[model samples]
Target chain A: MIEAHSISFRYHEAWVLQEVSFRVEKGEFVGVIGPNGSGKTTLLKLLYGLLAPQRGEILFELVPMKKMDRRDIAKRIAVVAQETQLLFPFSVLETVLMGRSPYLGRLLFESEKDLEIARKAMEWTKILPFSERPVEELSGGERKRVFIARALAQEPEVILLDEPTANLDIEHQIDFLDLILTLNRERGLTIVMASHDMNIASEFCDRLILLQEGRIYQMGTPEEVVTKENIESVYGCEVWIDQHPVSGMPRISLLRKGGR
Target chain B: MKIITLKKVLTISILLGFVLIVIILISITMGSVKVPPLRSIRILFRAILGLKGAGNETERTIILSLRLPRAILAGFVGAGLSVSGATFQALLRNPLADPYILGVSSGAAVGAIIAILLGLGVSSFGLPLVSFLGALLSIVVVFYCGRQEGRIHPHTLLLAGVIVGSFLSALIMFFISLSQKEELRTIIFWLMGDFSFSNARSILIIFPYILLGVFLLYLRARHLNLILSGEESAVQLGVDVERLKLVSYLSASLITAASVSVCGLIGFVGLIIPHSVRLIFGPDHRLLIPASALIGASFLVACDTFARTLLAPVELPVGVVTAAFGGPFFIYLLRTRKAIRTL
Candidate 1:
């Protein structure tokens, strides 16, 4: 389990996250949803050890994250940054192989075993044929999959994805989420994903953490946390919440001015 | 894969052979005391191979001492600059960055000029001493000021280098304006760049420093490769990122300063040779660094031949020849490379 205790952070003079706390367990898919500038990314960054908390500490298993070495932390947690802007033309295989960096020896070439692992990861993500192609030449959805392969190659226990579905098409987004769901249920991987799509989060995530202006408004299962009043009050939008008859999960739809 | 590697080796070897032949042919036949290529080789064989009664003394001395040392110096300087340039380009992740952009060249120029003006307290190797000092000081300044938090911000370093380089450049101009007319001519010639000044002693003293730099850079090949992913990635990859960046900046500056101290700035080999090689050879520094050295060496030999013989007896500074040819070629390569990369 990964736990954050009453985390607070102040950037320069302004506070960003204040008294936030949550837990992510093994095999659980927790979705964090918030508006822009609502500190969703900030919280994810803290979880990834990219930023330090001002008031509290985080624990991985039983060890405090601060006490763990970065490389050690990296061995267990993989992060897919929000913007995957690759400035140089690294080949797809080369980019994914970089995930194995923390495990290789200095001045040593990637061994056959390591290459095999990278190949397996690419195959898993279906980016194998593009191994020799420059990542700069790949399309948006392909690049995202390639990045996911890179993260998977790390073979980390916890995967923190910062808006993995952002900028993707509707079909691609669903496909990506389905892949994540498979990973969680089949492999027992702990997933912490942030998304702006409420319906997708409701259908996909095992639990939801609602953040509003840097504070946690609510944290519970989708049915318990996402409600008509909470959506209308927090998001300032009228929403109709009802059970999905098939999945038995809460589903919400924005009520337009005249109809829902 | 094996075939490609073999092909790359064969290609590089052929290019190297071409460079060596060009350097030999042009060095012997194009100097002030010129000789025919046949007699030049004969003379060079007599002196270098120590074959008695093979050639006359004048031809032998001209080939062995004067033109030959000068040619070898050009080759070494060309190769050294390009290698360092390649290293810096890899480190900074910016195609435009070179040892000069770190204020090393300006610093060396300022030092050489000051030594010329103040006389450096000793006549022996005064110019080099001053230039080395200048280069060293600028590197320290750039490394310290160029760094922030834990990483060297490429833009900030570039900006600092520009600021410092301009100040030093202005000072060099100021000194150039103040010196006697005769001294001024020598300074201008030095700045213009010529390989005709090196001797046995100067070469030996400077040789070890440049070779040491090349060795260190070669050793850090993998570390340099890791840096392209950004420092955070480099660190995650088990590299001591800060240390490697510091090493790269210092080592490249060392070779740049040493070469500029002996020969004036020969511009394009550093910027273009590595870039072109990378296009054909890929961005793997292990391959690019060594390949660039050979390509650069041969390139300078050809360029120097042109500098000496294009106008004959009245030698043009190698720098002028390089810029003249390199400027347009660089523009063409850069524009095309950018256009191709976007696709």
Candidate 2:
């Protein structure tokens, strides 16, 4: 449903993404994996229209991204960025209702229908109980859920996320991945997420794209792309690749260079 | 915006409106010449409705000619300052942002002081016009100096604003030092802010600009609420972030220019009222904007009343009173709300 065609982006003089192109079919769950500074976040931002590429184009279903109205694009594509800081104390409900803004008219307030949608999104994310609580007071994990709920409230066909579980604990990470997988399965939602967790990416995503030095190194199923050689070459880390005992998905284990 | 239930928002707005009416009545009643509150309210209503009343003509003259216009101008100034303050805080995403903080007041002060030196005093329409021009120029400078890659960096903007503000203050001081004794006293009094010069014509001049600016801002309250989620998120949510920012900046600066044009740099009404309102009511611009307007109007009316009557024959500058009250309140807020940081 989304395509990045020969997209190149740079900040000042340093090129962060160079001629990087990819495609995601409808209802596909794709994960972008890369080492630090490999442009994982940059690629996601370019795809979501936060940055205009220097070289090429992004298309949503066939329309050029630049041609589409921002509101129209927003209705179809929601983004859950990394951690957001708010100076004022907005309640969780208020933050979620802001997701409905794209759907609202200039002078119109949120209708009862909008409220119902927001509440349902909150309920699905299990944050309905914290609706009245200030969002600033929430934990990192809970805040991630609130952001996910906000994305759901956008009712978009595709969701883009940048490092959704970067700072999370293992338990929260599993819960977060589980929630995302459930959304993809139940709603047939197309999700493209940038993640640093190779294991989570291998276990959860239908396809993975490994990026190295602002270029796409490989794109395929996890078993096809996440080989020992690929990991070593891209990340400069020696690792052993094995299949998970229960899920039969590829798993990676780090190796010491000279000894144990 | 819907953080509070609709019922609660309605009740609070209605209550604020009532308080505003009571404040206006009391403000017009207490002045150099005392008038009963009931009589003052009756005179105001009769005057507004164009009905003849049996009250003494002196009371009517005092209420209609002097006190009423001063009270109304004070309310307008208060409302304009507070709404613009709220808008700036949201636009810049900094709680410390106000017209004064952004160098807009200093710019306007420079223009007004120049007008005073040139002998174009409060009665001249040119003073407000020049002040508005000066304010617009300062914003342009701030935006130019602070922008990077089409976005205004918060830290750079704040630093540029402070630099510009102090530079303008120095210029104002130079002009003040060059003026004669009478001009110096007049400039200082005007800088401190006094409602005594207010008349019906000044109200007529300020009314439309403030109304238009406030209306435009109120219409964008939802957009501003979305912006509170941070710029990139707001854009992803279809806020048209750049356009919204431009509109908000222009509208807010426009109103600030208007208020500073009429009342020379009333310091704390802009800074304190909106911050206090946000602490009480959650940061939903829909409620925050109008609530700030109402509370600001009433608060200024009360302050102006106190300013005029506190020393009997010698009136304190309304700015002095507001600063005296606002400075400590701001400190209290900063101390109590530990979440407030340099951003």
Candidate 3:
């Protein structure tokens, strides 16, 4: 479990995140939903200790993140960030093996155990067939799976994802979310995913946190947070809300100003 | 598709090591007085084993005193510059980054010029020591200027290097304008890079710095590979990005300084050797770093051989020879292969 006690962060004069506080329980699949510039990415970064909060603190299992070394923090939390550029020609296996860096000693290379773990992760993500291919040659969806496999290789208690499905098509998006959901259920993994897709978040997440202007606007079940009024108020857009046909979860659809 | 295992790295190292030894022997044999390859090998073995009376005295002197030291010096300079170039490319995330990209060479040139103007004998340690200090000073200034919010921004660091390099180059030009006629030739030759003045002492002086720098960089090979993914990703993967940047910058700078101090500014070896190595081997730093060191040594020794022998009584600057050969070969590689673009 992770806890944030009124954490705030800023770069220069603008506060990117302010007075934000939340806790994620073990094996929880939480989705953070927001419009553009709503500090969703910053929140994920804070949770993983990539950027320390300017005020207050984040704790992992009741221990303040500030006290943890980067390697220690990495062992417990993995992040699949948006826009990881493959500038070099690293193989899919090689990229995934990087997740074991926290466990590797300074002078030691990756052991056979480490390779086995990486291969197993690749198998779970269904990228084992292309383990020898270069990452730069993979499609966007395949690359996302590669990243997820890398995150799995870390064997972390929690995984943070930022806009994981942004550029992915609908099928790939659903496929990605389903894979993550399976991991949460079968492996007892914790997930905190930041996304702008309301319907996807509503369909998949157990709970949702809606953010606006660097503050949490609402936090509850999808039915409680995905209402039309809340969307209009925060996003300044008219919208229609209903239940998903299959899952019976709250679903959101955009409406034109004078058409609906 | 190819991941570099330790066994693969050792194999490639042995192959390249043999290549380097072959180049050194060939270089020793092909100089002004042509000692046969067998004789050169025997003389080198005798010198290494500290044996005597197996070869002619003059041939022994040529192999041990003059040509041997020069070839060794070229090797160190080649290895140092190429390793530094590879490190800089990784640190800056730019394939074009060379050993001189950070203005270290220009700073060293300024130091060497100052020593020459003061009439410091080239045979003394004063010139190289001063140049090394000058290089260190430039690294500090560039690092200071490149930091943003206590982290090194690659773009800013690169810009700072360019600005500092140009400024120091201007100072060099000013010094050249004010120098006496004889001093001008000395300064110009040093700036263009020369190995004619190399001896046993110069080789010994630069060996420790190059070895230390290369070893430090090799230890961080995995971290450097992680960093090529992007700084934020590297941090999330448990790499202390700032500390890695600092260490890489300092280590690479140390090697560049040591090389420039001894042999002036050898161009193209640093710029081209890493790319060639990366093309032949994959971009894994463990293999790339050592491979670059060995291949670079051979390339430079070969170039220096051509520099001294092509015109025989009239010597060309080793820098000129490196650029002359390296530029065309690099262009050919770029045109013929798509792999360099991945860099």
> Which candidate leads the pack in DockQ?
3
Under CAPRI classification, how is model 3 graded? medium
Candidate 2 global TM-score: 0.94
The segments of candidate 1 whose C-alpha lies over 4 angstroms from its true place after superposition are: A229-240, A243-248, A255-260, B1-30, B36-54, B119-124, B149-151, B232-240, B331-343
lDDT of all predictions: 0.78, 0.86, 0.90
Candidate 1 residues A177-243, lDDT tens each? 8888888899888999998888888899999999998899999999877888778788887788898
Which pairs, if any, clash in model 1?
A: none
Candidate 2 residues lying further than 4 Å off, grouped into runs, are B1-10, B144-156, B329-343
Candidate 1 TM-score over all chains jointly? 0.86
lDDT, candidate 1, at B242: 67
Per residue, candidate 3 scores C-alpha lDDT tens digits across A1-260 of 89999988997799988899898999999999989999999899889888899898998999999999999988889999998978778889999999998888484368788899999999999999999888999999999999999998888999999989999998999899999999999999999999988888988899999999999999999999999889999999888898898999998887787893
lDDT of 3 by residue, B126-155 (tens): 888888888888988998999988888899
lDDT of 2 by residue, B78-103 (tens): 99999999998998788778867778
Off by more than 4 A, model 3: B338-343
B71-160: candidate 1 lDDT, tens digit per residue: 777777888898899988887778887668788998888887787677652235777777888988988887778888877777788888
TM-score comparison, 1 vs 2, better candidate: 2
